[model samples]
Target: MSAGPFKVCMLGDFGVGKTSLVSRFVRSTFSDKYMTTVGVKVDSKEVARPGRDPTKLVLWDIAGRNAIDSVSANYLRGASALLIVADGTREASLAAALNLLMQARGLLPNAFAVLAINKFDLLDRWEIAPPTLTQLRRAMTVFETSAAAGSGVEEAFAAIVAGLDP
Candidate 1:
């Protein structure tokens, strides 16, 4: 199978673990620190799909949006796909994630998106409602990921790569 290169942008709210998620998926590492991403941080990973060729995912971890309206749409212009992340323990993050997804999709109508609700390892303290999960799932391919515990991260990344078909 021939390898294809795709640019995938990561979207979410501040402190929703966007950086950590990318770090975990790309470097197999995680940190509990809360550092802000200024503009866009790019990382690369080669993913193998089951019946298809490997894909080179150029993940662009965009800066967390204060609101969907404030996002720089230009940052998402060339993206082939998206990974909208949310924090499971913060209900507002999920709301923000949805809003971000909506706005980003509108900007790049052709880009495929995956909803990633991060910090799933803290499900015991999760504050998001069932209806919220239902909404996100209905919206796109959703993944419950934990960068700290390294759960569901690979699947989420793989899901994005598998979806990058021409």
Candidate 2:
């Protein structure tokens, strides 16, 4: 059966691997090189479930580190969910990601948010210590993910989908 389309937005700091996470989830692929996302990139995929209609998720990967002016607010309009991604190696980037979330919270207060700590594969050498994980969890649902290895990527997306309003 068909399901209604849902919009999901990805917000984070530069080089936080938001694009890589989306690519890994939607295309099942990953790349190490960093590429800046311009304006916004939209991708649609159907999420299958047992005994229920498949949900259509329209993923929006917005540009990182861009000005959070009126234009950025426009991009967040009508988003059903938000994936606030941050580099596990950089605590500052996580703070920046939180700021972005705060900016859109007014517009999407009910929007489900999943805090994805990207690049879990680099956990051994991460600058951000374990304490940060505890702090992040207090804010939202936190997932330690490695897009490069495809670990917890699909599960994270599924968790966000489960949180979305039906």
Candidate 3:
């Protein structure tokens, strides 16, 4: 990995648990209270890789937006990777996540990206079908995560780090 920290932008629809995932990974904590992100919340974590120096990741938790805008595009500037999150319980959020991915790719075609189907703890209520999830996994690196339960949270971050340029 490079000496400088990599900037990772979180892209997803509203209430997709992007903030919760960041909190869980960075602070080893989660909260039930819901707080809307105003602009962007920044956090950092250093992850270790075997046989290589530790790499620092600067996480940018952008406010949820169904569509891309000037403000959102500005937030994605200089991103090295994208952690596209979607709410598993709400299938529409998946569509939103895909849209966000397209926009992000348009801006940063070479940036590494990963999908995180969040809220796995609420899988019983998920509207996304099994076939769709299987298709998604075939298309990209996908992680079923539940920030509330801490399931797959660390693995998701680790996957992002592993996928980045070394």
The TM-score values for the models, in the order shown, are: 0.91, 0.92, 0.97
lDDT of 3 by residue, 40-83 (tens): 99999999876778889999999999888999999999999999
lDDT of each: 0.84, 0.85, 0.92
Is candidate 2 or 3 superior in TM-score? 3
User: What local lDDT does model 1 show for residue 81?
Assistant: 89
Model 1 regions more than 4 Å off: 1-3, 68-71
List RMSD in Å for every model shown. 2.1, 2.1, 1.0
Show where candidate 2 strays beyond 4 Å.
none
Minimal lDDT window, size 10, model 1: 66-75
- After superposing candidate 3 on the true structure, give the runs of residues whose Cα lies further than 4 Å from its correct spot: none
Clashes of 3: 0
Better candidate number, 1 or 3, judged by TM-score:
3
